[model samples]
Target: MVLGRGNFSRSVAFRWIVSYAVILLIPVALSVIVYSQTREIVEYEIKRASVAMLKQVKYIVDGELRQTENLAAQLTVHPDVRHFLDLKAETGASAYHIYRTEQQLKKMLAANDFLKDIYIYSNALDSVLSGETYASARMFYEMKNQTGTFAYEDWRELMIADHAGQYVQLPVKNKEKKENTPSYIRSFPAQAGSGAAGTLLIPLNAEKIKTMLENIDWVKKGQVFIVDPNGQILFQNSENVEALSATYRKWIGRGTSTFTDTFQGKKSMITIESSDTSGWSYVSVFPVDVFWERARAVRTLNVLGLALCIGIGGLLIYYFARKNYDPVKELVNVFSLRQRQGTSRDLDEYTYIRRNVLETIRERDDMKNRHVRQLRVLQSYYLSRLMKGQTDRNVPLAEAAMTHHLSWTSDRFAVLLFYIDSDEGGTTDLPLSQFIVSNIVKDSVEGRHAIDFTDVDGTLGAVVNVAPGRADCWKDEIEDALAQAYEFITARYKLRFTTVGSDLQTGLDGVHQAFLQALEAQEYRMVLGEDALIWYGNVKPSEGSYFFTVNDEMILLNLLKADEFEKAKGMIDQIVQRAFQRQTPLEMAKCVLLDVATTLIKSIPGPEQAGVAWEEWRPLKRLLSCATKAEFHQELHDIFDKVCGVLRSRQTAHAGAGIGDQVAEFVKENYRDPNLSVSMIGDRFRLTPQYVSRLFREQIGQGLHDFISQTRVEAAKALLQTGASIDDTAARVGFASGHAFIRVFKKYVGITPGKYKALQ
Candidate 1:
């Protein structure tokens, strides 16, 4: 059991798995924390949104109430009304003088939308005047009977009494529509302790206030209420108003504007917007499940998203960890001395691996020169493959590393690369020359770092294990050693060799990465001069490569298809120029240029439709062969020029044959849209408005706007003949109002819509 436990605990694979599982829990914990913190924010936003909407209702209703109160005060002290109530009128009220007061009342009633009717009482005359005419108490009561209750057996007693009370809502009918009208009463003779000269009564149109509430910006499923200053519910939309009325009254001025409370066994969110002018409150109550469901949905989505991420992230972590663990597993299988020579179980995994690798190295060094040469060839080929992938599978790094006596226990590694840049004419192809160069490089840096050598494509690569406790200044030390090797090789052999180095990286996989960066930096030799040493990572720190994105691909294709070849080519020019100016390696530059070339080829419609010949095969292969930046840019431009010609023809073909008919058909189908004008059609077909209008006129034998107007008016004729009202017909045909519809209908049909409908 102790031996088994030691093997398990020392496993690198086990640690990786534990680390992967631990990493996946980060997002899970973050999702929980984010959901808890954001729920309160969501509820506050809901309250703030509700309050903002209700405030508009409050403003409109409050303004109406204040204006009505002011109007009532004005009517009370009016000259005609005061003359009728004068105590010095010895012969009592004159009929003609009272006629003016009745006319004023009628005008006020007609102007105000909220007033259903108005009544004025005079104690001196012992008569009540109303909006219409002088009427007896029986006649006035019958006209406004349902609106309010009057406790007057005689007019003098009724006029001198104060009728301060809540507003009353009564049903008022007009044709088939029945709406409620609420009544408000105010006393005149504005004295503290004096007899009331009369009373002014106004029956407010509650339907108008409800209409104001209905115009609230955001519609929430809720009950709306209008409460007066006295806490009386003037109007409510709930079916069980009596049940919720006490709750509404209790929650008012509860020191908080919005809160959740249960009413009639259902929890509700109450939002209150109080009016400043009249002290009236605009209140909305909605079921929590109905109104704030978005908050709950957010929390639910967060949980589901967290679960989904854990599932996906767990699989991804395991796949990567298992894949990365291949090297260690292969190493144990290949060179486990404990398994091969039956060593003691007391030896742990690392100690067993180190002993096996050291014994193998001893055996390799004892081999003959022929065997050594063959081994070098195999190591060179396999290590060269590492230049292409992070971990090359051609030869397992574990076996190659053990056989080559490469460092197996180091924490950091980097690359030192050198190449014969003076052979720009491609003259040198000597195998012995690369062999000599590799030996000199390995000899110079061998003592300072553990080194392994690989030679491919005439470039010598040295993989170095950074010395322990030397990670911070490893770059400077390695570069200094490489500088000495470059000088010795060039001065002695007249070979202008440029050196490249990579930043120190971690793990066995990092050796592969170090090889890749060295190769990428090799491409920048001609751009930065043949003698310059380059670091791929430090090319441009502040500005990253300006590579083409998905949006750029779409824009380039759109411009090409529209025959905006000038703009498309300009975009390509910008992409290439900006990427080069940013001083990145040719990898990003190649990818960006290849993408632009592909999009340009895709923009060419087709062979038969393009009326020309073009080939998409081997296009990118040609791009990759360009040796220098100038040659690469020129090749991409050549492709652009060819595709541009095909696109111009495509654009011309679309404009020449049936474009007019297409525009005319589109207008006929969408003439009901008020925004369907020349510019909209031009944008749809990628033509100027003038060009589209002229083509439409030539094909359809009418101006574009005139045809649209005629089509709408023709449709209006059918609706009008069906007894649909003029305004409804106008709106149905997309006219802003009946007036614009009538004007256009007359211009097209040689008569107004009304006249045309009558004739139809």
Candidate 2:
């Protein structure tokens, strides 16, 4: 049945469903057909490519095997090698000479990249020469003592057992031989007058051969193995290959031609067969999936291409349907004009505002320019007073301003300067509108009073010279009035404010000093809050010492002892906050804290126990560079915690070595000597006697002499080696007299010296 558009259109839902199903099925059916054909082509191509690559690999591998065989053959014919074997046959030859010859062979083998190991076996000589000679005679004797019959099978068995088939054996002979016949195993009898008499068995370098195989570019990424004619794998790269399988073992002996076989338990498409020249079979494995993977990619591409074509056809139909409609052009033209007009209006308003603001600012700036020279004079006078250490007092503003030819005799005022933190966005190029605001506030305040206000430095400050007695009264009134004005101004125009109130001062002399005090007061706001009004009188003089409470000290001590860095940091922050509240000089406070921390770290344990080298500890210079007190405290806390952690670990590791115990043991063992001293004990332990003596005195609460003397007198009575009278024994045990020893002995031993000796 043919489905017409009119009939399908009438039933829209059914029509779309059927159309979509047909559209989807068309690509799917075509994809199935194309996938089958393309898969076949890709599989054929992959197989062809793999075969070509295997051929190339075989060519390279075969060439390497031939070269190795040639090298082995040369060793058999070498005159030095032949002479060594002949000498080895005689029992009179020294082993050292044979060892020297082996070393020479090793050097030659090392120079050749293709040789893994080279060994010569002489049946008549009854000796085997490995590539390298042993330096020790005992080692040489052990190598030369191996006993076995001169047969290739013995060599093969030894190699296979030793290395587990990671090595290949190559036996090169001038003639072929029958199995089980020793006569056929004989070497090429010294040609006429020549003297070569040994068969050489060399172990092939499997990795080198594999590398050569890899250079072929088509060998695929897997193992290439070589096997002997005895159905044994002579060499393999991986241990995963099952050596017990008869089929795997038989593949090696299957003649000198290429064919496919499974290897290493995988269904590998391996090219296996023997080399006609070497009789060693090599297997180059090209996995089956290498071909199948190519087929999969081709199938995917064919389906994707068919779908792309269908999608393009649908897009073309949509494009033609849209082209038949109209009126997008006219609407676009109308909107374009409106966008242009809006842009022009924006530019016009921006330019007009910018011009007006710039012109008004310039006029205000020009009028304020007359005060710049006066401000410079005022700055010089203030700086002079600062240099002379009169910072707390004020510079007289009227006297300084009059010196620069400005009349301020009738004006009465107070100076106020405001600072605003820049926006959270970042520093913008807004040239000090806060300065303009300060001027506006100053003008408003002056307008309320009969006073004159002058800009100090561009937006940095303003100077107001008020009447002498009125300075203190107007300071508060003006500050409160201006603060309200500032709050209004900043709210009206988005900005931030920080105000510094100068101390009361008169005229031009104190004006400059007052301006400086105002500047100093602003610095206090960092520790104080934002938008803060800091006054000169409110600034406390720093005592230069932080009063940490007993609890705080214990917290710090526990942090250091337990190696808790975060807790230490928090404690330090609290300390710094208290210190800053007291107005400690930031630098001096930082130095004091760092010094305390360094002392605490050093006092934790000996440097070795601490595990921190003296050089690793943070330097005082680095601590001092911290701009804020809290930062310095944190750095100190971190260093102390690290030092303590190292100390705790070291203490845990060497809990046994207590100096007090060591001293007790020393005194107990050596108390018989009257001349014994702390110096002798110190030398034995590699410590200064002064240090040891101090430790002993502290722990025992007595001098080392009193302890040693008391113990020695008691030991003397027990010593039969001092076969003398009790008085002589007492004298020998560091006593002035026998009576004194008897007195001390009775005190410690609960008996007189003579009676103690009689009991012994």
Candidate 3:
């Protein structure tokens, strides 16, 4: 058994090592190449995503700042504030009209949610009103006494002296004098370039600025601090004020606008800049650790993928080395020409041949599967085009069938839809039951017709072609064939089944219409349970309207008012049913729903109390496009409730207009005029007759005619007291004649004009 050293050197083990080394090296090199390329791509993608997010955040911050500036500009232009400033400058009035100005400022501030407070600081009067109309003067006196001998005269002197130059610097002292603050003073320039000789100081809202910064989506959380131009810590997010103050001092005097620094040993990215308007520098510190934490997960995924590739490559080398050596052993046994033995060697050879044969078969199967998939795709594309009434000139029906590997030589065809209920849910993998059903349909109609099957939305459609003229006469036979197929599938495959057959028609053009009818018949599965065959022409037209009634409208309105959206949806469904029952077309019902919704929406008040106009409700149409029927109903209810609220507000305003009192005064003054009427009174007041009528009806519960006649008749009775003739009295109080006046008098006073005069 001893072999030479040279022969052993050329043995299978040596070759195996060479093969393993080559095989292993290939994947190692590939893994390194993949890792390097992937790392670069990941880094670039992260940087790109981060830059995009930062730009979005910057845009949001800039928008908010611009809004704040615009608001300030608006406040500066206020007429009341302007008048107060002017009055204070001319009269040096500390107390005069200060209460009125403060009240106006308070109301203005209260209207906006963003405003914390608004104050008018009068440089001339040397007084401050913190948007309060009625704070006691005694409190101000006490504050002045407590703040180290402060007085209005000292403040006035400071303002006048400050405005005498281009710029002024003064100490800002709080009312409690806990800390001294710096104030940069500048003269308020007049609108026409003429200088207004008054000092102005705007105290920045540090908290509000911090809030604006925090609202930025990309601003990293935790310990956000801002610094003013003079290196003061104006705001801090952290509760530990002392730590925040310490952190601010370390970077406050730094000349750089942006730089990275460490806070409590954690790396932070800080951005600092002076505001263009206030010259206040804002610093934002975002910790790098937070950013790195997000990157960690991505890094782990990349590393794991690389490691997996390397491990698989190593396993492949080990597998190849072990398997390749076994072939060498078999070769040695064959060369030796050993004595007769068991069939082990033969079995190994047979196994190898079988494996090779199976691999070849598998490759062929894969090719066939790919070909079938391509055919299905073409069929689906053509079917969609056919349904939409489009034709392809390049591919005729016969050529299309050939291209998709389908048989189309039959003279006539009928499309059959087979619905199978299986355990599999959703549009993922097709179920085995579907394949069985297809086979059953093929078997049942064997030799009688040629059939092609396709899957659509979890159901199988079989296009069966029979001889021309045979389909119409054999329609019952065609249905029986499909029914038998369906029953067999349900029993054999243990699956529920539904079959819908189209009318017997010829060619692909007929197939489209047949497919449509087949689909329509399938809808009957809702009423008739599975395992049944439905013919196209046998299906009836769906009865009833798809809309609700007036009672449903009331129910929906009440539900919406109470904010019960779920119950409102149920009622909307009922309404849809009732509408369908009333023969209301689907399109008309939808339009009615849209109108109800839009009317409700238009009734809502505008965001700024400007009141919503009909044009603003136009957006409701776009909202309607995406809304479901139930959702549309709820939206309509919401709009109506808002409109009702606006109406209530308007009604209250009208009632408070003193319409009843005004009408009484008007009637009293005009009662003796011959031509006086409600219409004349309405014209005098510049009001519509209908509006006046409504007012009278609501307030007095009487028509305008009744009120006018009562007043005129009473006036006639009073004139009679002066011993005037009935005709003269009637003529004086807006009556045409004694007889006409007598008729009205009797109607009202239960007596004729002369009788009323006799009673007097």
Candidate 4:
């Protein structure tokens, strides 16, 4: 009977424990799942809201950029602007012209409060005229010295970087006023001619950018920055600008992207938006915890409830087991003693429950660890895609990263690169060498720096997550770590590794840009040599003047005239090499080479030998469509070789025809039409105007002008004899004005047009 009662109590205890566990776990699990979903929803909504606000900010910033571009375009077409830029006179007219042009520019400045000042850079005058003040020659030169020719060269680079894009230079302190001015530059004439007209600079109001960014309260809670195509931080409205800018370097070309990552040891979210016009990116950063703080309370309550349920369930199981097992007490004690011999038997009844609980916790933790590992792998792949500028479906990527437990939304990033020199000659095994390098770098920077190193081919690329307030010394820290790595690798393997790193960027979007910049810095290894940590700040844009000088043409002509074909070829190569070295616009380089070709043609025996025919050459035609420096250089060589062959054979004899007679015949046949000028004649005959005029006068014993005038008067006299009106005669004979025609007719015939007509 006692045994039967023990069995009944044992059954009751087992049922109660199972029932209580079911009652407790259901609510806790549901709460956990619900909380996780809620947190995700909240983050998604915040990202959407932030993106919408960023687009609005982008709209405002892009609108301002467009307005500035339109203003520049309008100024390019302004009558006074055209007149001032196209000025050819070097004497008395420039002062009045400069004054008038300045007045017009000043009026433009007055019309727009955003325009602080204007600079008109006249390449023809070799002067940069100011609209803000009445600048004399001395003042202009002084200003040029202060501003530097590098500024002008940079503008040219800007034009080349994007033909349709306007350039906005970073903030600079105004010399006259103790305030910052951000210069907006746009060159006149979208395409350059033989000579450039000038560049126009409008210093915009920087405060406007600040105001627009300030209105983005969500992003501004962390920081906001505008980055240009060249990776320049144009404007920022944050106390930690250095930190923010460092982060922005990573988001350079990211059109639209968002991710959650850590900043300053605190979790954060970052969003980026790019402008269609200027290619400037707008970046917004916000703390992550701020968006999910409410979910923490729900999780805490669920945890407490789950612990209470387990505690209550365990007590009931113990109570019922003791009450039900009274009859089987001896049997239970024997089993307990045997179990104690094998394991810990001091707390026998509850041991089974404890073992089961421990098993459940271990399984949960194991699953979590696996998920985190999977998330890291996904994050690595996403980072690669981001660096490659493939964030078109960024929302999905972010979701995948979040699900895997990887934070895709980092507010700041830095790319660290390790380039193993091909000629270092330490190891033939590339993978092993790369692995060793990565390990060394990782070991040196693992805990203190949050960075991921990936093998990008032979180069080991490290994409670092920059903590906030760390921008100032990030470079120093990176350099120090790299130095240590470098020493460690060299001492162990004797392999030389060159390290390069980009500036701190605002988001993962900048990772690709930073990598590119780091690569660019690596290229400078040709100039800077090896074993040095080359930073983005060390590599500068080419600042040399890109113009082909008169002396360069003279040297080429002298070589061609001397029939030194090899020397001429070398000279051609030099010209190409120098142009590319200076980073000259390919268009400008083409113009220079064509100019050289023209010089070669003119330097030949006579005009007809090289005239009209030169323009129709197949090589010249091919030159017009050539896209690269190599193709252009080859075309130049082909032209040079053909010219050299013609010189060698003396085949350019032109059938013994004299150029002066040809010019006379041409003028006699075409003089009746208007638009006839010395310059036009020179173009038709492939000769300089001065050269053509002097040759014609030498052959005809009078100036080409006198001969053309005499021919026109003779034609007008015949027309008058036919009873045509004075205006009709003037129009027929290519005279622009009837009064001028009448005067010329009277001067030649020694009478008025009517009297001359009656005599005829």
**Per-candidate RMSD, Å:** 26.3, 24.1, 23.4, 31.9
Per-residue lDDT over 317-358 for candidate 1, one digit per residue giving the tens place of the 0 to 100 score: 889978987776677666553466567656655576787788
Q: How far does residue 733 in candidate 3 sit from its true spot (Å)?
A: 59
Off by over 4 Å in 4: 1-36, 94-99, 136-138, 141-165, 168-171, 175-182, 190-193, 243-248, 253-255, 293-760
CA-RMSD of model 3? 23.4
TM agreement with the true structure for every prediction: 0.34, 0.29, 0.31, 0.33
Model 4, residue 37: displacement in angstroms?
2.6
Local distance difference test scores for all models: 0.70, 0.57, 0.59, 0.68
Give the number of the best model, judged by lDDT.
1
Error of 4 at 444 (Å): 94
Task: Report the poorest 10 consecutive residues by lDDT, candidate 1.
Answer: 146-155
Q: What TM-score should be assigned to candidate 2?
A: 0.29
Candidate 3 stretches greater than 4 Å from native: 1-72, 75-77, 88-100, 111-115, 123-126, 134-158, 161-202, 210-222, 239-258, 265-268, 286-301, 312-760
Residue 513 lDDT (model 1):
77
For every model shown, the clashing-pair count is: 0, 19, 15, 17
- Expressed as tens digits, the lDDT of each residue in 1-760 for candidate 3 is 1235665445555566677777667766765676567645544544444444444534543454454455555556766566666654455554646666677766756655344444445544444555743233334334432245555556555544534222122333454443333233444444454545244433334345557656765554645554556566555555453544565665766643556677666776666554554444555666666666655676567578767866786777678767876765665555435423432333333343454457669999999999888877787666545533365634566776777676666647677877667533422235666677777777777666677776765567777777544655566666677778766655555566678787776556777777788877665554344656767665535554434456556665665444344565565456544432323344565666664564345334456234363555454665457334445555555555555566556645755457867887788888878788877877776555666777877887888878889999888888988889988988899998888898998999897777667777
Q: Write the per-residue lDDT of candidate 4 for residues 640-698, one digit (tens) a residue.
A: 77677777666334322477788888888988878888888888886557757877877
For the record, the alpha-carbon RMSD of candidate 4 to the native fold, in angstroms, is 31.9
